[model samples]
Target chain A: MAAKKRKKSTAAENEIINLTNVCKAYSTGAPALKDVNLRINRGEFVFIVGDSGSGKSTLIKLLLRELTITSGYINVMGYDLSKIKHRKIPKFRRNLGVVFQDFRLLKDRNVYENVAFAQRIIQKSNKEIKRNVPSILSVVGLAGKYKAKPRQLSGGEQQRVALARALVNQPTVLLADEPTGNLDPKNSWEIMKLLEQINENGTTVIVVTHNREIVNAMQKRVVTLKKGVIISDEEKGGYIDED
Target chain B: MRISSFFYTLKQGFRNLFRNKWFTLASIATISACLFLFGLFYAIVTNFAHIVKTAQEGVAVSVFFDDGLEESRMQEIGELILKRPEVSDVRFVSAEEAWESFKAEYLGDYADGFTENPLADSAHYEVYLNDVSMQSALVTYLESLDGVRMVNRSEIVATTLTGVNALIAYVSVGIIIILFAVSVFLISNTVMIGISVRKEEINIMKYIGATDFFVRSPFVIEGILIGLIGASIPLGVIYGMYNVVMDYVTTRFTMLSTLLSFLTVDEVFRVLIPVSLGIGVGIGFLGSVATVRRHLRV
Candidate 1:
């Protein structure tokens, strides 16, 4: 029995994120997430899909520790989201990379600076920044456009810059919230491809997206949420039509 | 808190200041105006206090002797007066010297009118004290001595000067408190505007795993710089104005210069420099810290 318990503990330790019956309620006393239990392991690529007000953003915020859970537990990268001290939140977040839907790149800075910004936040040495930034820019296929500002780049190129920034720190997990919401189909596909590439490279990628075509075509694990409850968890799944 | 991070935050702080140039300039101007008034009042009060000190030093108690007091006994009394701790100095004026001085002053052209010394019995000891406040004590002591006829003191002058000094101190403290508040409020407003302008940038920084110290350091630095720059401008202005005013007072008001001497620029700035800079930096730091705590939740 002790050996079996050790094996189960080791399995729990291997999971990058574990949410056991987690529930989150806002000030209005309405439940945003209800009895949610899910787990994503290392190097896994998973998608969280839900309609508006379906607790998708709330789940993301919980993983980021932006919101405290109303009940149950959330463990991200081994840090308990519910019990993590306020001062340790930044250090905890450093292990996770986040990409927003709006492509939140510093407009005044160029591609190189924007990518280097992530490295700078971690206080990387100048030599490391000079080395790592260009290497990451190259990975994002924006090495030649290092001097171009955000406004000078296309929507696809800007998203790529945001991706470069998110990946520069080599985080254990990459959380992309509607990362392709503002991009065209071609750009969105390119971003999804990059995310898949990043996951294959040994980073857990959890994306919250709404593009039905991309979701169906990707053939990845899909976790569907309806009215703050997980309705489906399927392997190689597509977007479930609610209508 | 690595040295590299320190430098980075320092660079960000300067960048923030330059990015919001208008707000920076406005804050500096406000701080300068406030310090300028404070400096002006400080200079006036210091000079007033100095003049009062000189006047107090000159104040003395005139101790007259009894009729037919011998020269040896008067000398003993002078020695006794000199032994008092509050007595700074003592000058005994003989009846002959008194008559001579009186004639030299009121009877300059009628010196031959006084054939003999009519003021022979007016000999007295002028007792100079270290502090004007000790006049009452010394006066009482002198009046109680044998062969001492009367002890006359400038009580009204001492009281008025002491009152004026106290009033100046109270007013200075009150004005300084008000000015400091106004300066802090202005700096807080400027920092608030800077924060609003960079709200999006700040949000991104917070999202990107930057600590509260990492994010707040730049604004705090910006505040300190504003304070330093703001403080320095008025010191320079006051330095020049002080010299000019001193020159005008010495040359333009020659009559007043003999009775009252203003402090040299160096003497004034020796205190003003540190105080103004300290206040400037203090206000900046306080304003930035307070605004950051209130507005920047992250």
Candidate 2:
């Protein structure tokens, strides 16, 4: 019984975030989440897949403190999500990088400056930006496109620039919301490969996707939500109904 | 972040202002026209007052003694005029001395034609009154005195000067009010446009941990620079026009012997420095606060 308890304690030690009865509802009288419970472990890659309006984005937003929890406890990186101040959101966000489906690159700035903007907000030194941005650009295969503006770049290249900006500060957790939604199959696979490489470097990554092919290929722990309730939490889970 | 980023934003603000040149030109045009009109008004008021003061100084009463009046009687009348509260100074121009001066001045080379100086054989009492308006009462008082032939105080000139001075005071107050309203309207709109254009940038900056003061300072500084620029165009124009008007007044009317009453050339430049700075900095700071209050979240 002592050995069994030690194994259980070790399992608990791997958990980075634990959510208890988390619920999020909109003011317009529709429940977006209903008593949802989730656990994300340290150094784990998580793919949250669901149908439309299944509370995937809401879950990500809740974790980021962009939306407050309606009626549950969410302890992420040691801070209670419901009780966090609006001003303290950035400090929490500093530990995480968020990538959106639309590839929100600052159009007025060139690729370097676009990436530099995030670092500037965090008050990174010029020496650090000089040291890190080049390596980050190289990692995202955007070395030669530093001076190029977002308008001048192709969709794949722009997405890569966005990825570089997200990864520039070396965030511990990467939350990608349909990161390759606008990319071609070839580019999508390339981005997936890059995400896999990043995950391999010990950063916990959570990807929300509607693309079944990429979701199936990732071969990670998948949490499937249906009508704001977790229907399945499976190891090495593929697309929802694959035999 | 370092305070240098604020400087960076200021540089960006100026660059943005210049980049949008059609807007800049429109602003500059309005500013220039306003300054030009303001300068013109100032010059008119200045010259008007100068003319009035000159007329006032020149409107003295000449007390011509009766023909062959005794020197003692003339001295008594001079002493009496001097004793009056309204009189500032009294000088005596004797008939023979006055004739020789008039011969040399007005008669010129034709002085020999007059066998006798047919000018009145009288002592001219040059009377300086304390106020030009008081000259009428003073003339009445002088005429009431014994042995006084005429009291030559120009009532028409005094009345005209009083009317002009009143008009000048009214117009100055009106122009200043209009100019103030125009400047406030212009600077507020300019700052509002700037805030609208940078709405996204401001949002991103705010979210990125920039303090409220950091985000607002650049806009305030920008406003001040813009206002300074707005007022500076007029400052230069006003100074230049001051020189032109000073030279014109000095050349045309030396007898009035008046300096530029509004401002001298050097003083005009000196006054412009503070007035322009005050208008520019004050308007800029105020407009920026108003703009930021409407736009910035904090």
Query: Which one wins on lDDT?
Result: 1
Give each model a TM-score: 0.89, 0.66
Q: Give each prediction's DockQ, rounded to 2 decimals.
A: 0.65, 0.18
For A78-173, candidate 1 gives per-residue lDDT tens digits of 898888887888888888999999989998789998888888888888889999999999998999999999999999899999999999999999
Residues B65-149 of candidate 1 have per-residue lDDT tens digits of 9999989999999999999998889999989998989988898887886678999789999998877777888888999999999
* Tens-digit per-residue lDDT, B61-165, candidate 2: 888877778889988998999998878888888888888888888879888888876876655999986667777788888999888888776778878877877
In candidate 1, stretches whose alpha carbon ends up further than 4 angstroms from where it belongs are: A1-7, B67-100, B112-123, B128-138, B145-147, B294-297
Interface RMSD of each: 1.4, 3.7
* Shift of residue A149 alpha carbon in model 1, Å: 3.0
- Output the number of the DockQ-best candidate: 1
